[model samples]
Target: MAESIRTGRRKPAGPLAYAALVAASLFAVGPLLWALSTSFKSPDAVLTDTSWIPSAPTLENYTIVLFESQVPRYLFNSVVVAGATVLATLVLATLGAYATARFRFRGRGASLFFILMTSMIPGIAILVPLYFLAVEVGVYDSYLGLIVVYTAWQVPTVLWMLRGFFQTIPTSLEEAGRIDGASDLRVMVQLVLPLAKPGLAAAAVIAFVYVWNDYLIAATMVSSDDKRLVSVGLYNYLSQYGIEWGQLTAAVLVTIVPMVVLFVLMEKRLVAGLSAGATKG
Candidate 1:
């Protein structure tokens, strides 16, 4: 009877389910495939050939973007800014989250709420003020300005995420550390942080991606081409004469490579980190 009930409850795979999955996959990857096709086509072919498969493919676009343009510089700038932002956000968020998770204090709930609320405020709303502030503070048109803004914007969300992850950690571990005469700071550094590696890895990837992809702050904060990020640097392909679609698409594909590589390498940790807090709160 139990075997019959289990068989009856199992849903059979349907053609419609398979069809929907294929359609969704195409919809998501369609643009990327088109861009890849465009990047391989020559200048004239890009406009004349509307077919998904290019009639004639060339390496000219890749050659120009890699060696002839400022894309490499822009890429370096993005890496620096994103890396620094991740480090700063993790440090600040980890400390703040640890305090919130371990210590019982007055206004803790209110403080966490306020921090999360800051993230809810649309970044666009403060663009002008941030621009003026960066200028007034002497950090305008510099990597420092971009890193500082990105760190400030990312910290609140990361703090809340980490706080949840910290809660999921057992208090008995910390108690054991205390029994060994370890200081709170040492306990956190040695015991808590090592266990929270997955959460930290997840947070770092998120913060890194945010800074790397942001266009507005990179554009508004830094006017110099030398300090421009990859997102804003892509605009260089558009000139008064016309747009270089082939080169632009090639650059786009190249820019996506780093993120793809990162996701591939950190997929496991990211999944674990994201799910770790789900059961706690």
Candidate 2:
């Protein structure tokens, strides 16, 4: 018993469990692997070759997407919009979350409930209203319109996430800051926020991904080619002529690179933040 405890060993996973895990992973990753394989094949090979490994891989698809298409422009637009949305959402969510977590005020419960309820409403339900409002405000077909809409849609959820994370932090830290003559703003900026880095990282990644992948709002809010986001710009691969599957797959892979890099860099913090937040609320 002492040796078993010292080794900290648990029961090994049965073969069935390993097989189930493998099946689930393959199910999730199969499409992406297919897309990657398709991206490397030539136009003729894309239609004729059904094999996972291409007979002859070519870079023509990547060349068309990178040098000859507007995909680069669209990628730039997505980065700008997603970055702004994440920044604005974090700033607003952090303040709102801290207030809800640390202070008691009139209608606090009702206010939180209302915010959460707004998130439950489908985006499609408000599409028409948002469109007309954007047009009336003279922001249609502009980056500002897209960023504003994305920020508004993301704020409630991010606020809830950060609020739960804030609750997990000890009040003793804030009290100590107060005792040190720090104001609320100073306490938050210098101490609480520093300690909440994992939570902030998690919230920022969520907001960024939401804006990056959104097509409905991007398509409806902006009509100009220059302002189009990656999600909307991918439609260029489809036309009356035909779908350019090789180029389309290449572009798809390109668009996912940023998100992949972000996840790789922030994996540890994101996991820690989510685990901590979930434990408390």
lDDT of 1 at 155: 97
Q: lDDT tens string, model 1, 93-126?
A: 9999999999999999999989989999898999
**What is the per-residue lDDT of model 2 for residues 1-281, given as tens digits with 9 covering 90 to 100?**
64577456877789999999999999988999999999999989998999999999999999989998888999999999999999999999999999999999998999999999999999999999999999999999999999899999999999999999999989898899999999999999998998888899999988888898899999899998899999999985556227889989999999888888988898877877787784576
TM-score of each: 0.92, 0.93
Residue pairs whose backbone atoms clash in candidate 2: none
lDDT of 1 at 134: 91
Question: Could you tell me the TM-score of candidate 2?
Answer: 0.93
For model 1, which pairs clash?
none
Taken over the whole model, the C-alpha lDDT of each candidate is 0.91, 0.91
What is the lDDT for 140 in model 1? 97
RMSD of each: 4.1, 3.1
Q: Model 1: residues >4 Å from true position, as ranges?
A: 1-16
